[model samples]
Target chain A: MVDLDVEEPNSGLFVKGKLEETNPVYKMVPVWEKDKCTFCGNCQKVCNFNAVIQLHTQVLVFPKLCHSCYACSELCPTDALPMKPEKIGEIKTFHQDNLTFLESCLNIGQEMAVQVIAHTNKILEKDYQGQLIIIDAPPGTSCPVIEAVKDTDFVLLAAEPTPFGLHDLKLAVDTMRKLKKDFAVIINRFGLGNDKIWEYCQRQNIEILAKIPNSRTAAELYSHGKLIYKQIPQVKQEVLKIANKIRQLSGEPK
Target chain B: MRIAFTSQGSTWNDPIDPRFGRAPYLLIYDEETDKLEVIDNTAINQVAHGAGPETARKLFQAKPKVLITGNGPGGNAARVLENANITIYIGAGSLTVEQAYKKYKNNELKNY
Candidate 1:
């Protein structure tokens, strides 16, 4: 399983894996050299993200806003704005029995989670020899989540059963439909909220594979960084059912 | 001394917008000529990010000696103003442009 939520890679908290390999990911940012700069403002003008600004006597580059496009660094006449690789995030590979876990984490002040996620996917594609890749994508349908699920065979959306949950679930459904991805839903805390999500799923013709029961025991175990699949019989049954469906979708024999 | 204020409208009576980057108009008040120049910030508003620094860059081109605004500039915008040698006086969000200017002169505004 790969945790593409680099901003908050919490899957490591639950998965008991021994650390295997670690790698640092870097993004290029234009570093302004004081003496060589003519202050011509070309770099500033070329920057579409407003990452570079030419003041009266000095040039300032905002590292966070920089998308690492290399426009300013490449177009500089004096070579004052040289491109430098700055460490933005790190990737860790772990092993637990036969399962290999890949987790990428962004640095505290890093603005680009998509960069880290893309890098993590590259690592998974190149290094890992796993047959079935389960990707735990970040919540919401933003750039990072899109990057996570873009190449996946199937997406499993786990949702709570509430008004707010239904609202976000609709957004996720819309996004999935727009992406033209094959996906199924899993209603978490099933007995808690009204059956609006179920009704909505039925209307949309979305297949709900399983419903994990609302259990305080599961929540308690999760808070302590424990996996409840073994301890909680209900959660284990639902998870096993989902696993079987996923295997079937992937054409894996029972 | 030239002073810059981020305002909602082009007039002096317009309430000072607390936001430096996304303000509707940037008003530059010239002390010597008693003239006011309004800069349209609609372009900055349309940008996805770095609005603060972009707005700061525009404000720098106007050559304002000081900036008077509501909550002062944020991290990225503040860095630009600091490098440009421009002082920032804040707590003008609740005041009008004229009142902010008066407060700035009275040293009643907080220096950011």
Candidate 2:
């Protein structure tokens, strides 16, 4: 079971329970030993991303281009390829009385974030069958970000009130739409600029879940590596209210 | 005669399609005839992502007189093609197949 504590006033909500179960969606890469390799180059030949190369003296694998599909190992004729557990990221689980915290980080020099997402899902206990999952995804609209949100029930897209944020938010929204995922918006650091984002949301009929004002206290808490809800009790109450609103929208039990 | 152009994505060891997008079309222009036949290319069907060495070997099987291509040809691709002693025209994608043959006829284009 998990609990979500909101950290904004008139903008926060809280949720606590076990989330739904999702299947594992990411795969790890496999390394092949060329000693048993016949140099037929089937693995190199079948790679769509050109991750594997066949040199005259030796074969080469570029980890940056690898997607961990294990296609090379699956198709190796000589059985030279073997898959091992690769570390692309970690999942941190924090516990409080009624609040849960989870954060995911990607490893350095890793091109594919899917593996991290896979590991993140793995870290969550399957026994928690009725908890809420609140994911803070990495920024972008590419494949990595897409994979991060594959199993999400509701995505809270955080967009800043700026032209650049609007541009990238459109891409992110388009990507989510393509995936057919339900989502809402959170206008972070509100009141610093005009309501252009709100106006756009109203015109498009996109739901505005919440709006958070700029706060130095929240900034300081984040800089200190502390949860805003813990540093400020008001934020925690707000997060609980937001969670209730989300529950109402999702038709889940309060 | 079948000739192939060698480049980053071309299969210099096998007879394949020429990589057209990355470099000039490796066109074997007939001297007296304007007939053009594509040689070994890593970019067959305009797919310019990977090289096919099998394509290069296939090109060697066809045995053309002049192999015309672009710059950066001194890789594994160039070495395998040069084994046949076929005249290599570096940076010749700008010339038409007929012009390539004419330049060769006049002994103007030389191998590097």
Candidate 3:
């Protein structure tokens, strides 16, 4: 299992794993030399993020605003801009039972979640030995989600049965269709809200892979960092059924 | 000198647009020839990000000496405009594009 939620990775809280290693991710940012710079303001003009600024005699570079595209450095006439690698996040590897867990955690105040997520995905692609890899992607239909789910075999969209959930689910479905990825919907907290989600799924011809009922006991177990499947036998059976279905769909030997 | 104004319509009688990046049109007035040119800005409305910076870059290509808009440019666009040595004037609220340009010419508009 791999968690690509770099902004807030919480899978480690539930799984008991031994931390094996951590690797830092870095991005190149431009550093300017004041003496060599003529204050022509070319760097500031070329920068898309307002990372570079020329105020009177001094030029300031805001590392946070820098997207590290190297446009400023490349456009510098005097070659005063130098690229420096700045650490943005870290990827942690762990061993839990027979599964190898990889999680990407972004540094505090870092806005580059896609970079870390892409780095994590690259590491997985190079070293992935498992037949079936379950990736827990970030919640959204934005760039991060697209980066995480792109080129994957199947996308299991989990959502609540509320109106907000349906709205977001529709967006996710639209994104998936646009990306042309095989996907199915999994309604979490089922029976708690109206039947709007089910009706929409039916109307859209989207497959409902599984539905997890809303249960106070299951919620309590999850809050305590306990697996709901392990606490509830019925939930365990449902999960096993889902696993079987996935294995059958993916053509993996059970 | 060339001056640019964000406008809601293509003509001089159109209201000054409050937005710098997502405005429907850019009304460029040339002081040398006393000509008015309108550039469509509707393409920027569909952009999800970096619209301000892109618009600033487009304006920079035109080499405008002054930008007279109803609203101040965002941080990204401001950097691009400042780097290009283009002075920005604001407070053209609820006025027509021609009125805004007239106010800017008369030094009645505020400079940020």
lDDT of each: 0.91, 0.58, 0.85
Q: What is the interface RMSD of candidate 2, in Å?
A: 6.3
Error of 3 at A2 (Å): 0.8
Candidate 1 per-residue lDDT, tens place, A160-205, comes to: 9999999999999899989999999999998998999999999989
Q: How much TM-score does chain B earn in each model?
A: 0.97, 0.54, 0.95
Per-residue CA lDDT of model 2 for B70-99, tens digit only, reads: 453434444445555566655544554445
TM-score of each: 0.95, 0.59, 0.71
For each model in turn, which proportion of the native inter-chain contacts is also found? 0.78, 0.09, 0.00
What lDDT score goes with residue A160 in model 1? 92
Give per-residue CA lDDT, model 2, range A100-214, as digits (tens): 5554555555545666665565555463435766555667786557766777777778888787777877888888899999888887776666778888888877887777666
Q: Model 2 compared with the native: what TM-score?
A: 0.59
lDDT of 3 by residue, B9-111 (tens): 9998999998887888888889889898888888887766566766776787777888988778987778768877889999996899888878887999999
lDDT of 1: 0.91
Pick the DockQ winner.
1
Model 2 chain A worst lDDT run, 10 consecutive residues: A3-12
Alpha-carbon runs more than 4 Å astray in model 2: A1-27, A98-100, A122-125, A226-241, A249-254, B1-112
Considering only N, C-alpha and C atoms within 3 Å, which residue pairs clash in candidate 3? none
**Predicted candidate 3 versus true structure: per-residue lDDT over A1-254, tens digit per residue:** 88898899988888799999999999788998988988888897888665776655667676766778899999899989989999999998999889888888989987878888888888877888445788889998998999999858899999999999999999999999999999999888878889999999999999988888789999899889998998777677667767987898779777
**DockQ-based class of model 1:** high
